[model samples]
Target: MDEVLFRGSRKLEIMQVQAQLVASKTKEVFATYSQATKALISQAIHSNQVEQLKQNIAQLIGYVLEVTRDFKYQVTNILEPRRLWIFFSTVLGGKWSRREVGIACISFVIGGAVGLGVGLIIRRRETIYRYMEAIQISHYLGPEGATVVEDAHAPYECGQHDVLVEVKASSVQIIDAQICCGYGRTFRRILRRIYKQSSSDLPVILGRDCTGVITDLGKSVKRLEIGDEVWVTVPFWSQGTLCQTVLVSEARVARKPKNVGFEGACSIPYAGSLALSALTEANIDFSNAKDKRFLIQDGCTPVGCVLIQLLNNWRARVTTTCYKRALPVAKALGATDIITIDDSHYVRDVHEKDPQEIREGDQKLLLKELEVRGETFDVIVLTRNDCVDLSGFCTKNGRILCTAPEELLSDSCGFFSRLLLTGYVKLKIVIQNTLGLPSDTFDEAHLCHATLDRLTEMVEDGVLQTVVEKVYHPKDIEVALNHVQSPHSIGSTVVTFR
Candidate 1:
């Protein structure tokens, strides 16, 4: 059992396996409660077998403890401010080999004596509640913009509307990577320190989505309770989910359905809520959805996929466009029809196929193609901001929505001047950027709990699913981000803290 467990762990580390692959290892299924009774009956006649099983489990736990302890702390003297400062410098300076060598020497001499005396004494009394006090982070040194501190300052406090959670899994998202690599880094640094209305302090961690068990509840949190397993999209800059524990708002929290594993739950909250908000704001008539024709320009995008499923559940006649590789997924997600795009010469193909039909200068050629085919959609969702003349296909009274910014669509000199012309051409076009004008931007989390409740029912009813393509450790966050950021990504990449 010891050898097998280590082999499995090593294989997982090498393969970067997803949650489903790990779940497949447990094949013994018991369909009824009587199975437990039968197992107990067998145990009555098999005391030796039960004892052997107990021994195996104990040995496995011991091995796991040693392995986890070794990796959990590189420098355990976290309380000593001076050593922490030097240790952090070495980490940021790329002197990890030297840091490990120093750790080995110190751990051998000072830790050796202490390990023999206090290790056994402490291990017997330790609990998961105590784990909350550690406030561990894999990276602590940074002039590079996002590395955080290691100490009890993390696993942050629960606020009036928050719930304290021991995060089982968190995920790397594109926005998170953008922030880490210094998208408005200096301005954010200044704002966080001096701004009166900012949410949290400087270096307030980074993970965006997570699944965990509620360890503590806030004063105003009525919807959740301690020990409830939930998923949350941690609101911006207050407290991140990268640590062992996180404090999330009740409004941003949702009960994770039994069908959703921790790894998969990490991916659902942020994208799901955003898509839900878009669809909700669209105000589609679900009772007559089949009569409502909708088109999603990029069906394989994260939010696009969720929208497809939601539209399907609403019985909408949904048409989607995607690369040839995504045909199967698009169909499985309930697209009524799919238009496959050839990446090699997408623009050229559209032009060559219809050079004389629509002679306007670089109009939304895609929409023109649909117009030539006499296909009009009531709702058209643009995943990318492009030079697309949506007026050609959108019904006059219907809606054309751009998920991206208007500035992205124009390449020529007259973009700003042409705004009125463009608006008049497609009178009902909606830019999501202005959805909640007069506010900073759309606050999707405001509708998070409501959206997730509906999504949870869909998941439990087997109508929707989470796509977790890869899983990683917190130490490999950059690698995980790269995977999800790639154009080939079909699903989300998650990071496990447990």
Candidate 2:
């Protein structure tokens, strides 16, 4: 009876050992499975459909690593000799359970097969998912060249799709007024609130003034395709224009200019539009300007210089203000009258007489008195400076055009009073180029490319010339800006990109 009791105790111990062995083997199998899962996911990440693998497999690595660490400690501390003796007794005598090993093996095989099937099903679902890689341009605000805010992904207009354009070189106008006048902070606050309100499924891209070839195109797109060279304009708020690749509207594009390379063409989509608008307002008839008078205040500005030549070829009397530095070129461009405005009335009286004179004996003073006595001209155009008293300078019933950033008569009490009380003038805006107009609306017209091909012919024949002074590379934009802002700048400054 004592021997039987000892055998029974030994058998019970063997059964405990078998249970521990099964637990250890199960942990080893799980560790192997976890490693296989990691290897499979790593392979998938390297494929082209990497973006489609949105499953947080990296997170799984952390969880599995923790489980593996705990299991390893348990397995290392296992009492193996005692476990073996207990297993021997249980297998040989107690349950007659060698047949059950096949059952356990089959269960593990089925579980592994099921896991693989589910993994394959998940991978198949991911295969069809697509995502956008966007480029964004934002202000370099932080020390690491970060922005306070950036335009991530904005949704497409539902079924409305758009053509994506990637830029090579671009510049965004930063009105310092917006940043300095509290408007920027207020705007940023509003943007943060809006961002909080937004959902996270939005797409994101970044880019700035840049040019690049189209590397890919969506099935819905038609106007452009892969391998097309395009120019992209980035707005102040980064939306993908600064990105390595950007999307643009098909309508916003023109065929890349034949003469200018991609580097030069990139700027024209934005600044060229500004230049075109200014010239359009000058209203020089390409066919008939050869006999009219058109005056430019600072004839050397990009817009002003372009307008000068456009007016010159139109046969309009081209009058521009030039000091000693710019006089020679201004005259060479056919400036009918080049007035070097000074305190002396001597130079101005030589052609139009001293129109700005304050004394009766002075021509300017006399002109002022004549204007008061009801005198005017067919057209009066003002381009620079706010010192000109536009309300007081007009002739009765004459057309006036001005480009001073100051508020109009309605915003000034004295100026408003004159316009309201004096009933002599009937004002009509022939054309005013404000920020509202599209940039390219007047390019072909100003260049007279189609409307008056004769003007293009004249330009080609050296009868007309565009006044370009200096060209700077993209990196030297600050240098170009300095020259443009210089009081002594003579002609138009162009920053060429390579």
Candidate 3:
């Protein structure tokens, strides 16, 4: 699939290059032809009888129109459907569609547009996707270099199925560091090559989450139109949303939830994708989990917060372990029980699974917090994959949903060895059931689209809330990244790109 998109992009680039060459040559030829034709026709009008001169000029007009029609059909065959659509729309306006019906009088529209030098400038093809103001990072930021330059990257082009958004605001995420510096080391070398330091390459765009107004649309795009306000989490490899204007694929975008403002919408993409994917893919029957114990670790983090809100909406018996500060919001989101992470000693009690689970409780130490009288959690959610081991978290055959890929690795490797040592415990990280591996398989669009749909419902119900800590300007991206990395981060940190 990657290979196919790469080839398609290459093909598009090649046709564009060829079009420029052809348009340039056509202008040169037309200049000479026009000069010579005008000179000869003028002499005939002055020297010959009016009837004869009119006859000669009429023949030249027929020849010119015939040639232009032939060339247009032949050359456009090489152009893709999207480009051809753009070309005709921009150069001919509504006349292209009217061409067949009004074939007899084609010269006024087609010829007039060409005579004004419209066809001679193919670079205008970029008007659909081009933007003047965007955030750009020319090179990877070192451990200390966390700078983002706003007011850069102008006149970008929208490709096929791409939508041009006049960004009202965009937000930052923890992954911005990985994007700015191309800093990541995974088991696979594939991603490292793209994200690694670059000596001579186009600057990488930053910011993935945004809410913006759609000012323009590519020829092939139908899902959205100009004047629509949408929220999107663009693909990391594509252009970043942290710019004055961004060209994004329609598939990765969705209608902004009306309940949230741009500031809140900007923080939903990655975190929401992870949380919702964790719940659905983990195969939890949210409706049926009202009586089951569901443990969510790190409720202080953004992903955990979203999970708690969603699980609570399902009336699931949710128990979260977070810092003392996060307990309020977690509880407000319908967490039936809360446990603090700062306690030295926790009271762990064993209990039998209850059909009617306990509903709500004050914050308690992990050891003192008895989720139930007997059985362990039916589902354990690790917001971050910091679990040293998974043995104590779940009952036998209990499902574990973790956001970390490393946990999946540890779960897979030394499986037999660990099973013998720790006894039998079946644990599965959250997205593994759906994604198989963190990124081993390809997802069609933003993995969060379904989540976004559900988010709309939750927001309308006045139950789901976007956790916001601080909103920063694009120039202060470094501050936002620092906040997200800091233990002091109150909730989600956002960078507003107004």
Over 4 Å off, model 3:
1-139, 180-202, 343-375, 404-450
lDDT of each: 0.65, 0.46, 0.64
Candidate 3 versus truth, CA RMSD in Å, comes to: 27.3
C-alpha RMSD of each candidate structure in angstroms: 31.5, 25.1, 27.3
- Cα-lDDT of candidate 1: 0.65
Q: Per-residue alpha-carbon lDDT of model 3 for 221-251, expressed as tens digits? A: 8777789778777545455677777766666
Q: Is candidate 1 or candidate 3 better by lDDT?
A: 1
Best by TM-score: 3
Candidate 2 has its poorest 10 consecutive residues by lDDT at 423-432
For each of the candidates, give the backbone clash count: 1, 44, 18
Output the better candidate (1/2) by lDDT.
Answer: 1
User: What is the Å distance of residue 285 in model 2 from its true position?
Assistant: 4.1
Ranking by lDDT: 1, 3, 2
Candidate 1 global TM-score: 0.55
Q: Give the clash count for model 2.
A: 44
